[model samples]
Target: MPEARAPVHVDGEVVASKRIGGYRHLTLTAPGVPERFRAGNFVAVSVAGHVTRRTLWVHRVRASSAFGPTLDVVVEARGSGTAWLTAQPVGAKVAITGPLGRAFALPKEAVSCLLVGEGYAAAPLFPLAERLRERGCAVSLVVSAPDEARLLSALEARRSARSVTVLTADGSVGQRGTVGDHVDDLVRRSEADVVYAAGPSHVLRAAAGAAERVGAWSQVAVETSMPCGTGLCHGCPLPVVGEDGVDRVVRACTEGPVVRGDRVRWDDL
Candidate 1:
């Protein structure tokens, strides 16, 4: 594992921005971000440098001499903060603090890994696929969305994983069904030893359940509203089952955004 650097506040310039289907992909040129960034880590952008900030998961990181390092994030303009973010033009400046929160812990041995994601939630998993492949793991992906137009990073997933399966609710894409509907079959077909997922609570619950059915270890990145990216706000707490079988609330910003799927109290989610 690489050492994690302290978080820093930096002014980043939007080097590139593109509208991909229903999401906006932005590449920001900022010094010292790439080296500190890890797959599954996120950045909190202070929209317009105002008090209002939105937390976004990192999609990719790269090196750049022009700006030192670059960070990428996929934004869905569902709210005012994201609307403002996606509307920024190239060369626009934004304040950001990151590589925040715990990252996915890759399995030590080379094992078949199944990654499941939905819509924009798939943003972080591509980077994770790169790391898993580097570790000699055979990676497969199951990406789900409402329709073909909403499938996030399908090309990227195909490029990164050994195999890719897509699912859509309206049958406008690869298959007609929710990811949960095919998770068990996918897990068995992939011969996956571990499952990693990020999406809505219900989807994650189904993914976890499917993994359990196959006797595979499951790691999940949970989604929640983060008013403060740091743990102080206590706004992103989720119920988790402790070793003693007691349910306790843990802040996603501190303890995890990635947690053991079996340890999470899915019913409480």
Candidate 2:
């Protein structure tokens, strides 16, 4: 495994911003950040006139654009902080600190993999899928949302993943059901040797359980809130069993954001 580079605080310029589905997709020129970016990494952006920094998934990285190296982020307008991020226009300058957190570990050898995601949180999985395909792994992706408008990259998944499956509660785009209803089938059909997932806690739990049932390894990118992305505040606590079989609390932003699904104390969290 390559060593992770140190995170840098940079003032990124928003080169492009677009509204896609229920999320805002922003492409920014983050000079130092993009080169170090890996799948499952996130950025902490300074919210205008706020003490808190809103963390967002670093959706993908563009190695060479007209503006130089850049990274993409998918922002959902939920709270005031996120709303501020989405409201930024083209050429807007925003403070960005990344690439933070441990990234998903790719298999050392070619193997079958399953990636599951929900809503806009699916951002990180796209890059991961690409990396897996490069390693000659059979990549299968599953994206879900409540409606068609919330689905992310259903069409693009066909181009990247060897197989694609979509689920929506309203049957707006694909099969009618929730992740809990279809994840097991997705796991079995993919014949996955490894499973990776991102979304809400419930969705991660479901994916983890399904993988375990089939005796496959599982890794999940947790969507926990962070007050300080660099682990200063120690605000986001994640419960997990240490290698010594002892329970311990770790900072999600530094210690994880991505962790072994089997190691997490799901019920405690």
Candidate 3:
């Protein structure tokens, strides 16, 4: 196990904010985040400077000579909490508590890695791809969305991975199906030794299934409703099957948000 760092509360200024298709991208001038952040870690952001907050996964961590270190999160304004974040003006101050949760573990040695991401879920995988490439791992990506407009970061994926595949539910993009529909073929073609995926429950299950079929290891980042970005709330628990065939419920906030894909009882979820 890794040592846990105490969460720090920082007043982060909105350095930049933009709307990309169905998501809003926010860059915050958070001082401690860049140093403490991990690829799959999320931050508890105070909404509208209120006591209420929302847990947002870290999208990117940038270290700039000019602005120091900044943290980015992609927001889908589905509810009031996220809507408030998207509405904030540039230079507005937002409270943040994070670099929380476990991160996606990279393979120990160089190997072929396949990454699957859906919509805004693709945000975190970019940093993971960059790190994998640094370790001499061959990285490939499959980006999926409902339509062409909603496909997240296609250009960025092309630049980061050795190969990029896009899928759209409407066939408005490269392929006409979910990433789940194409994952098995992608895994076989890439000869991927490991798989990492972030998206909806169905996508995670598919990624796990594909990895299992290929006898490859898999890690998945799951999205759940986390009222308290810590284990205390018991708001985000997922049933997992242990190695001993025991069933246990784990908190997504502390134990995961990232976990071995095979451990999750997807049907139960």
User: Which has the greatest TM-score?
Assistant: 2
Q: Give the worst 10-residue stretch by lDDT in candidate 3.
A: 1-10
Candidate 1 per-residue C-alpha lDDT over 136-157 given as tens digits, one digit per residue, 9 for 90 to 100: 9999999999988789988888
lDDT of each: 0.86, 0.91, 0.87
Q: For model 2, what is the error of residue 48's alpha carbon versus the real structure, in angstroms, after optimal superposition?
A: 1.0
Give the lDDT ranking, best first: 2, 3, 1
| lDDT of model 2, residue 222 | 92
Candidate 2 has its poorest 10 consecutive residues by lDDT at 1-10
The C-alpha RMSD of each candidate to the native structure, in angstroms, is 1.7, 1.1, 1.5
TM-score of each: 0.95, 0.98, 0.96
| Model 3 C-alpha lDDT per residue in residues 1-269, reported as the tens digit of each score | 23226677898899899988888999998778778877888888877645556988778888874578898889988887888889999989888888888888988899999999998877889999999999999999999999987788898899899999999999997989997789999999999999999999999999999999989999999988887787788889888987898999989888888999999998788
TM-score-sorted candidate list, best first: 2, 3, 1
What is the alpha-carbon lDDT of model 2 when measured against the actual structure?
A: 0.91
